[model samples]
Target: MRYLKRHRHVGDPLEAALADTALGCGFARPVQHEVLAGMAAQVPEFAGGRKRALAHAVFTMLGADLAHDDFGPDAFDVDALHPWAAVQVTAAKAVLGRAAGKAPLGAGDLALLASTQRQGIVWEGNFFIHLLVLHALADVPGMQATVDEGLGTALMYQRDDGGMPFVTDTDTWSTVTAGLALHATGAPPPVLHRVARHLLRVQHKDGGWSYTDRAQLPDTDCTTVALEFLHQLDPYAYRGPIRRGLDALLAVRGSDGGFPTYGAGTPSEACMTAAAVNALSTQGHLHHGIIQSALHFLVGSQLADGSFPPGWSRSRLHTLFRAHLAGNHSFRTPPPPIRSMHEQTLSLVRAAQRADGGFGQQDGSPSDAISTSYGLIILTGQADPAPAARATRYLLAQLRPHGGTPSPPDMLGPRPFPYDVPVLADAFALLALGHLSRRIRPCRAAVPGRRHSGSRPVETDRAQHHDAGAAHSTENTT
Candidate 1:
């Protein structure tokens, strides 16, 4: 017997043979990647996105035009929609109207609709969303049974505090990000080795890594970070995995030649492409023809104001940071950004700093630890030491024994909603602090147990920051 069918949508150019098949991993991937590889990219726009497409599809199946505000009271001809749309809208609205409340839905009244749920934008199904759909349907007839199955899945990620994360966790991301931070701070070789081992241990058969060990579907961001971490330590040793990951990453570039978060048909994000460029350079692909094309894409993507298209993050600094990373690794005596682009970016970053020496996700927004960290990372290596220095002071004040001050979520999920994974804050802050240690002298308080050995990128006492007190506090707070 096979798993029950979930959906039958494989719109556009074509579909997988299994598009109409029973649910399982088969239906989870609806697109025939090879066939759709030549199709145009679908950017996530507010006016016409996966949500709109899904609505159109549902209407088509219902033999109706999509219901719209344009069809208000007597604006458009309802006669044009006829009995078909009239009947379809009433019936569809009946079920959807029950989906009234917003997410974190405790009542079966609200729904977690998937405009496009192939991912929570980047990764696949997560805990909170499962509960969202489950709770939304629990009061409805016939859906009472799905509550057990859905809650069973959601509760797998339930916290000891009886709470759950939107996504269960970003184990692979947290590991590599935190590991890379700790690595820079001189984390024990054994600890770093274990991280490398875990990544290696859970790598998918297709030669990619996912956001968590439990997941087999991989994305460019996680895979690139994992590759970067492994490459940094021992490129020669991890060469096999690196090659495989590069193959997976390179395999999914859009027709535009930029990388997407996950494989095939997804929009090619500038930040993701930048990351791939950086990671690929570690493999000596900096001058490869593919890299050249990607570099060109990166150059063209930058706006006159010196920004690139935003990535999955809500942080303004995310793309700039990624672009910096990609630019730093290039071989045109360092390629991209050209002189004007670099100057423009530095100007914007400088202008965005708050008087408190912190940076917000956007200019004029409230200062926060994670965004400040991104600022510090961008400013640290610059010719001018001041902005980075001020950012360093800001984070220093905000530093808790746990990591950084609690910050707002900067990651966008399922398109518009935002969520936090907590460790991401810790990891980025630790990383920023490490970069900042370069320009300033550390106080006795900064280094609790260890001393910096006078390095180029001075190591902050992130190890001390995350030690005993932090551990206990996180257990209680998180």
Candidate 2:
């Protein structure tokens, strides 16, 4: 195994810049101090048990500093993290005198780590998962001995010239979302230009994109996201691809007038429809009959509490925020149905606010950084600033001094499998704070639509049966 002569910090200057941008967005000094203090105070809670303590120690070693206690043998747990993550955490703990003799690392542990690393990456090389594992290994004194060889193998999957993908060789979802966030947070033009170029190059011949470049199926979420990013970054330069993408987006409209995650036959979802409407309105495609049908579907989908059915995220706030954004972008003169749905959604979101100023995943779930961040972003332009302010306070309370926020574990994959990666939490927090500070730029320019020569029937793929009760993993998959 090849090893690097020297160790490097995984968290880069871009991450630090993002954190500073979030801070500059006008969080009060007292609020900042209070959040820092709160993070320190929560260390014990995170380290109270063996499972929790190991996770906490991993975060601290990664620079989040979630715990102050020496993570001794009592804190080590084989099942505390994802199996791959467990391997690295155990190694780090062993090196730190926390697991020596008591929970000593064995040959089996090393074999497992090497095998997992050799499998390339699961879920198509998710960046957060890779980053998490790298951070853990980098914390140990000699754990990076194999990093050079591992990274060399991994880099073989990178695209020739484009923004980094969520996974190797995929420039669809990750590139678009990252572009939006970075553009919003004032990332330089060269970076935005690079992202825009990659997006344009990878846009499927059908005018939309799949989660990964290799996946030919186009989904509403990825299509809309790509459109939104193009709209934000030099709309005119990439108008051709934007037009094709929008047309591809319209092609996926379900019979119910709502958008589905994948093909036409799939069930229409609120979040998918909301994303479509937002993209359409932003790009001046609001006049289409298909969009009106989507609007109706959105209004009809709202529950008594004004929440829409959760789509891709575990949190209702995620759906709510997307719906709200769709409404804002799509309607200059919303009809009664659209207007009523908007009002109800606002009330529901407001009512979901806990006394602690945080929002929960669902109506009765516990407060979390991810949900609270969504709530704050939704309330940013509202008439009542109180709720937004309160949510801001709640999010501030979750902030670690190292500029990362730790959210509760969220589910991923086709089945409900829990995955916890603190870097994701940090990314979302930065995005929400950036939005609140008005630092995030909005996409402009109306994309002109191209007319297809002949009418083609909307094609559908066989739908996978999903458990409604399972938390929808928000990994940008169709």
lDDT of 2 by residue, 1-478 (tens): 0111111222222222223333333334454345444333322222334434444443343334232545555455655343433554554454344322334446665455545454344423454435434543443345575555556555655555522334444446657766776766677999989988888777889898876775555678789988887877777898898889888888878788888776655557888898888787655665466668888898888889888764556677877888877766655566888779878987888888999999987666789998888887777646565777788889999998977788875433211223344555765676676666562223333334423565443424322222211211211111
Model 1 misplaced regions, further than 4 Å: 1-48, 51-125, 132-144, 152-163, 285-287, 332-337, 402-405, 437-478
For lDDT, the strongest prediction is 2
Clashing pairs in 1: none
RMSD of candidate 2 to the true fold? 16.7
Per-residue CA lDDT of candidate 1, range 314-376, in tens?
Answer: 677877877765665554354335545556777888888899999887655689888888888
Superposed model 2: Cα runs more than 4 Å off: 1-171, 285-288, 420-423, 439-478
List, in order, the clash count of every candidate structure: 0, 1
Per-model lDDT: 0.59, 0.61
Model 1 score (lDDT): 0.59
Clashing pairs in 2: 207-245
Worst 10 residues of 2 by lDDT: 1-10
Best by TM-score: 1
